[model samples]
Target chain A: MTIEQIRKTFDSFLEEHLAFGQPEGLYEPLHYLMKQGGKRLRPLLLLLATGLYDDRFERGLHAALAVELFHNFTLAHDDIMDEAATRRGKPTIYKKYGLPSGILTGDLALIYAYEQLVMGLPASLAIRLMAIFNGFAVDVCRGQQLDMEFEMREHIRMEEYLQMIAWKTAVLPAGALQIGALIGGASEEEAAILHRFGLQLGLAFQLQDDWLDTFGDEQKTGKRKGGDILQQKKTALVVYVLEHGSPEQARHLLEALKSDELQDAEKIAAVQGFLEVSGAKAAIDELQRKYTREALAQLASLNLPEARLQPLKMLAEELMGRKG
Target chain B: MTIEQIRKTFDSFLEEHLAFGQPEGLYEPLHYLMKQGGKRLRPLLLLLATGLYDDRFERGLHAALAVELFHNFTLAHDDIMDEAATRRGKPTIYKKYGLPSGILTGDLALIYAYEQLVMGLPASLAIRLMAIFNGFAVDVCRGQQLDMEFEMREHIRMEEYLQMIAWKTAVLPAGALQIGALIGGASEEEAAILHRFGLQLGLAFQLQDDWLDTFGDEQKTGKRKGGDILQQKKTALVVYVLEHGSPEQARHLLEALKSDELQDAEKIAAVQGFLEVSGAKAAIDELQRKYTREALAQLASLNLPEARLQPLKMLAEELMGRKG
Candidate 1:
């Protein structure tokens, strides 16, 4: 099935399956967050990976839904941890409801995600999927923890930042693909290759997000430009500037990030200028391109027919090509 | 093995296995909360249940640890939701570490709990346990949600109160015992009986806790007298008073519970007098006894020899006898 068809199926599953229980306070926020749509990229990856190995990708529907629910669970909790007020251009659950409801709802989502996971798979396959899912779940938490820690520290290495994002952002995608491959009856070696492809693709996707947060058109991205700069987030561009820029450039960039005197617009402009002048913007672009190429290389080496892999190739292009 | 021996083994496993990973901000609260230590009742129940059917209770060590960790995870998050400053007479994780840390640590503990669960069990058994664990996990969240909802509303029915406590406080114990029985090679029917046994015992334990909260010596309980009264918690005693008291008596009790003009001691004495005069206190005591009898009846019907059931009997007595 094509990625669009898979997404349509997944959306219907979500609509039919995501019902609220009693106590509106606990379950309402969950319904609200799930309705505030995302790209559904992780579930699509799972479906595409399954389709690559087996025609009966439909058998992996629960796993696909599980991945999407788990991803949203992380997002809901991470919003609280990050003190984020908005998600997908809508009020976050934490902001819309309160902290207790936010935390409880995320928890319910996680439990429901697990429930979805073990639904239809055989016992052995369910156990394997659980092991993989739990590993990635822990990785996501660790990544989030590191991200929070990094905010309080004055210095962080580029390598450390990469590791943090890989955990925070990449592992879910990689796990989704690997789980789908397993469900599709792929050998461990083949799943490993798909995992690698997913990891690189995820990295590129995140870098693109980081880039778009500062550089893309606001209309396309559905967000204000330079949001990362305004928040003083240490994205790839910021980390590159910190590590590779001249001392004066680094000092100016740091001051721009820390200055409460500057308005949001001024801060964004200053940080953007620093990134451009210090060549960090170009460097981040290069890194994004390199990872994208690496991901495609892994896909090419899979030896699957191009026609069968067309959906995944199209997805890769769309992810990398996003102005948003 | 005896309950004491199982507890000792479990403690050693905790010391050896509960190590935290990087980013102390996220992990330190977990370490602190685990170290604060509760009765270790849930894990003990698991071990005893395992011992009931199999001598090699050691094989269930990881599951025992998983239960304890998951319990602590619930405690950490619950304390935050309750806005509770202290647990076991020590500052709560939220009070000590801050909100984000409390939430994140709880998430980490839950993830680690899953990690612990999937370790060393056969695939089939692990899958079964996962299904059970996930069911109770959702139940706990649902229970907590109902509890928070209860706090806001003035009137709560006795049946609703019973259901709330069963979800909030009883299921973990039930799940623990049931899981242990499964690990011990019990049939599904046998596990179901143990589950019912646990449910009734858990209700007795919670009612005892409510009884102790107001009436037990402060020194023994390590908390202020009339804590539930002060908080206006809808305990079994309060529920009985509301359900059975004369209209005038119920009015007085409700006013005493809500009056800000009354001193703490006065409120406690007034509410206690109402409970005594209306026979609500006696009713709650009778209910506790009835549940305890039901629990023991289930145990007796299990057909296990008296010698094999001694530990569980002792445990039930100790739980019902706790002043603290």
Candidate 2:
């Protein structure tokens, strides 16, 4: 089946399983946030990686739900921690219900994610899955912690910034692919390669996102250009300037970011000019391309038929492509 | 070894395992809360239960840490949800670190819980333990949800209140005993009996706590008399008055509870009279005794040697006996 069909099948299963709890307030926010929709990228990665080794899509459904619910759980709590009002263009659990609901919903989702993981599996597989999933969870938590701490500080090293992004955004896809590959009978070595493939894909995807938020066409991206600049988010572009720009250029960009009086449009324009002059924009664009290329190379390192590799290749390109 | 030895070993193992993660803010709260210790009762029950079958306190240390961490995770988040300022006579994570840390700390502790659960076990036991822990977690979440919802409404059925109390306060100890018994090679039937034993013990423990807060001697209990009454908590006694009292009595009880004009001492005295006249105090006390009796009966049904069962028997009586 295609990824679309897998998504459809997964959604039906998820809807049936998710609403089984009592206390209406506890589970409703889960359904409400999930219904708002997302790329369903993590689950798809798991399913596709499973397909690459063997057809266990039926059993893989449990794993697919595990990653999906885990992702949503992070989003629910991250929204609360970030004080985010909306996600996927919908009001966050915090905004929609209250702080208590936000905390509880995230918790229930995380526990349920574990339930789905070991639902019908044999003992050995369940043990392996639990270990991998738990590590992935800890990495994400550490990433979020670093990100929150970074918000209060004036400077962050490029190495530290990359680790934060990898933990926060990249590990889910990487772990999903690795988990699915192992479940489908891949050797540990093969699973490691698949995880690397996903890691690069995830990094490229996030870097491209940072680039598009300021540089892409609003019509094509369907988002206002400079959204990141308006929020003063320390995206890859901002981090690049901090690492590589001249002192005057870095100071100018930082001042513009901290300035409340500057109009949003003018700030965006000025930051864009700084990005261009500092060579930061081109460097990050090159970095995104490099990761995309490395991801494909990792995919090629596997001895699978070209047809089996086609879906992952197309997805990496779609996510990292300049067209957004 | 005695329960004291088990707790000390468990503490050392827990400290070594818990502080491994980084980004100081994320892990420090866990350390802080764990240090401000309680009775360590759940882990004690687990270790003693393990002793009842085979002495595996070494391996049971992991299970002990899992339950202890799970309990603290609940406390950390529940404090935020309840807007509580202190736990175990110390400022709570919410009071000390703020809301985001409270949420994130709980999230990390819970994830760490799953990590310790599967750390070094054989596949089958780990699988069984995971399922049990996950179910226990969901029940507590549902219980907390109900408790929070109850605060917003005026009336709740006795049955509903019991379910909430059982879910919130009973499952941790129950699950701990069940897990440890199974690990020590108890049969499914044996584990079930142990679980039921812990369940009743937990209920009696919590009910006795409520009774003590309102009805026991402050000098002996070491808590202010009528503390729960002061908080206007809808505990079992209050639920009984609402369930069985005359309309005028129930109305007066509730009005006195809600009235700000009543002196604290006068309000406590008035509420005590309603409880006596309505038989809520006696009924709840009887209910607590029933649970305690049934719990001992469950322990007796287990065919373990008398010497093997002595520790748990003594502990139960220590917790449930009215001597204090």
Candidate 3:
């Protein structure tokens, strides 16, 4: 099936799976947030990875849903941790429901996600999947803790930022791909390679997202222009400018970051100007492109049939180039 | 193993397991709370359940560890949700390490707990344990949410209060017993019966705990005298009194609950007086005794040899009568 057909089917399963819980007051915030919906990327990756190995990818649907549900669980809780006001162009779960309800709901979603996985697979596969999922869950939490720590530090290196994104956003998808491949009867080494490919691609995807938040069109990105600048996020572009820019440019950028009273327009102009003049945006683009190349290289090393690999390569390009 | 021996083993495991991650800023709070120590009641239940079938309970130490880690995970997150100042005579994780760190660290502990469980059991047992653990996890969250809900409502029935405690504090032990039984090769029916026994006993345990919270010596409980009264908790005793008290007593109780000037001493006295005049304390004791008797009946029905059951029975009585 095509990516659209796969996405539609996966989205249907996610909705069906998420709706199976009892809707007491405790679950209100969780249900609200899980239904708010994001890109459904991890589930799609699982589905696609399995399909790449076998035409009968439907056999892996339960695994796909498990990854998706787990991903949403992390998002729900992460929103609480980040004190995020919005997600997916909507008010966040914590914003809509109080912190306590949001936390409990996130927890329920996580437990149920494991239930979904174990319900379908053999005990052996289910156990392995759970172990892998558990590892990913810990990595996500660690990445988040580091992200919180980064907030307290004065300067965050680009490498540190990359490592954090790799942990936070990349590993879950990487795990999903590897597990899906394993379920589809891929060799262990091949699965490991695919996991690396997915991790690199996921990291590149986040870097592109950071770049788009600063440089892409407001209408396309679906938020205010320069929103990240206004928030003074230490994205790759910001780190590049901080380290590489002229003294005056650094002063201007730091002034924007330091000043609580800086107008949104001024902060945006200062950071954006520094990024453009310092070639940070170009460097970011190059970094993203490099990872995309690495991801494709890793995928090619899997030595799968061309038809099976084509869809994934296309997905990588789509993810890297997309506005949102 | 004896309780002291089990405690020593668990203490060593806690140290080794918690030391796996970086023990810096974000992780320090989690380590502090987890290592602060409790009675290790849940793990003990797991081990005891296993011992009912075989002395090979040593093989299930990781599974038992899963119980304690999950318990600690709940406490860490719950401390944040309750905005609690202290736990176990020490400052709470959130209070010590800020809310975000506490949330992430607690999350990691939970993931690691499941990881440990899967490591100990085969896939089938692991999956079943996960499903049971997840179910217990949901009930725990639901109970907490209901509890938060209870704080706002003035009149909660004793029956509802009983159900809430069963969900909140009791299910984990029930699950621990059931999981242990299953791992020890008990029949599903037998495991389930033991689970029910544990649940009922835990319910009785919580009610009796409320009794001790008000009446037990400060040195024994290791908390402030009448701490629950200071918070105006609607414990089983309070709910019983509030429901059955005469209009005059109810009026005085309501006045005490509403008064900002109500000192800890006054609230305790008011609660004590209401319990006495309304015969609520006796009523709660009777209810606790009835549940305890019922739980013992269930345990008897398990058909274990009296030699094997003796310790558990004695422990139950000790739990029922303990001042702390």
Q: Against the true structure, what is each candidate's TM-score?
A: 0.97, 0.98, 0.94
Which regions in candidate 3 have their CA more than 4 angstroms from the true location?
A19-23, A242-252, A259-262, B217-223, B245-252, B261-263
Q: What is every candidate's C-alpha DockQ against the true complex, given to 2 decimals?
A: 0.72, 0.85, 0.64
Q: After superposition, how far is residue A316 of candidate 2 from its true place, in Å?
A: 1.6
lDDT of 1 by residue, B1-324 (tens): 767888899999988898567766667788898889888989899889999999998878899999999999898899988899988879999899888888888888887887787688888898899888998898898899999888887677889988888998899999999999999999988888889999999998888889878777787767677889998887878878777767776677778898999999999998888777778777878888899999989999897999999999999987776653
Positional deviation of B124 in candidate 1, in angstroms? 1.4
lDDT of 3 at A238: 77
Q: Pick the candidate with the highest TM-score.
A: 2
CA displacement after TM-score superposition, residue A206 of candidate 3 (Å): 1.3
Clashing pairs in 1: none
Residue pair clashes in candidate 2: none
C-alpha local distance difference test of each model: 0.86, 0.86, 0.80
DockQ-derived CAPRI band for the predicted complex in model 3 = medium
- Model 1 residue runs over 4 Å out of place are B219-222
DockQ of model 3 vs. true complex: 0.64
Please give the ranking of all candidate structures by lDDT, highest first, separated by commas. Answer: 1, 2, 3
In model 1 chain B, the worst 10-residue window by lDDT is B19-28
Please give the lDDT score at residue A133 for candidate 2: 93
Ranking 2 against 3 by TM-score, winner? 2
